[model samples]
Target: MHPKLVEFLAGCRDEAPLQLGVLPFGMICGIASLAAGMPAWLAQLASAIVFSGAAQLVIVQMLAVGSGAAPIGLTAGLLGVRHVLYSVSLADYVRHLPRRWRLLLAYLLTDEAYAIAILRYQAQTAAVHQSVPGTPPGNTAPGATGDAEGSPVRDLRHWYFFGCGLTLWLTWQVSTAIGIVFGATIPADWDIDFAVPLTFIALLTLLIRERANQAAAAVAALGALLLAALPYNLGLVGAIILGLMAGALSTRLARRTRLAREASQ
Candidate 1:
């Protein structure tokens, strides 16, 4: 097999678990969207255009509960606010792309794609950083310690991310259409509600490993519970704000403590 094909296949294998984890959620979103009176094509379009499973789920749920356009749109938009952060992180890798490509990429920037791409990008960056030349004669900062020639190869990683994202995108659209077409035939005994939270727990487990992250997540959970009764799931928005504040404050405090310790030394 060609080297690029091997690399691509490896990436697909590596991301299989995540793909499996997201497919059910995507299918649920399709069912919920169709159940909520959203057009099947609309669900597919949202999945294709927005391409974020969480945001699409929120939009469908809100619509199902009879939310007006403003609140429903706001909820979807807010859930997707994380994309701004994703764009910032992925910018370095995609910066040289054409204007149209950038716009298309921004539209396609889902969480899973961002996660996989960032991991690959970071690895490539570290490799490059370690290969820099012209270190000072006496400097000892692990200067130029990675493979500089490897930076451009990061672009190859984008193909894997794109393949994963596109596959999920197609799955979401098709699953949603099936639900719209046959929702009445499906039994209502399937407890998808339980599954959603379990999915979230798995995703959170993958992302949160540090004490600060744990604290931030705890605070967010507390805030969400406290505001659970708020109308139109505004509680979720509030929880996100509080979580951001908590995380930022925690980081600031950690930085200050480090500064103080350095000063004392």
Candidate 2:
């Protein structure tokens, strides 16, 4: 097998484990959509179009409760605000790719895909940094770029991203289809919708390694609970904004403190 194919397959294999969480969430989104009175076809269509479990659930719930179009749209848009940060962060690595590939990647860019891709990119970057002439071995920092000689890794990066994204897209679609088909059969007492928050919590646990991230998450959770009475689920949007602000401020302060300490030393 070609080396590129091997990388692609490895990417798929690496992403396989995440499906354990994703599949159930996808199915729950589908089931919840139907349970909330969304038509079968439209529910499936939202799965394809929105491809966001959280956003889809919010949409379905709002629609079921007869929410106005503006609120529904606003809620979905607010839920997806994080994607803007993902796109900006990923833009540099994929900037050299063709426009069509960029467009497709943008469409397929999900939380799982971003997590895997960014980790891979950072690893590759660290390797490249370690290889630099003046840099001591094993002393590479984040955000370092590999040399032009590392072109092969760079080339394979896109294929690996494609494999991961495609796997997620297929898994999500199939799982959602299953849910739509058998949703009515699943007992309401089962409360499959719980899987959605469980999946996010799992993802959040993985991401909260830094103190800033931990602080942000704490603030977001508290804010959401306190503001739960907000009309049209606007509390979610508010919580997200507060989380971002807290995270950003804490991160900046940490960076500044580190820099000042270094200067003093």
CA lDDT, every model vs. true structure? 0.66, 0.80
Point out where model 1 deviates above 4 Å: 1-10, 61-67, 123-155
Least accurate 10 contiguous residues by lDDT in model 2: 136-145
How many Å off is the CA of 118 in candidate 1?
3.0
Best by lDDT: 2
Task: Please count the clashing residue pairs in each candidate, in the order shown.
Answer: 5, 0
In candidate 1, how many Å is residue 180 off? Answer: 2.4
Give the per-residue lDDT digits (tens) of candidate 2, residues 1-265.
7656776786788788788888878888888888898888998888999988778888988988998999899889988998998888787677777899999989889988888877777676667666774543223333222466653223557677788888999999999998999866878798666666776787787778889989899999999999999966778889988988999999999999999999999
Compared with the true structure, the alpha-carbon lDDT of candidate 1 equals 0.66
User: What RMSD does each model have against the real structure?
Assistant: 5.2, 4.0
Q: Estimate each model's TM-score.
A: 0.77, 0.85
Taking all chains together, the TM-score of candidate 2 against the true structure is 0.85
lDDT score at residue 61, model 1, on the 0-100 scale: 78
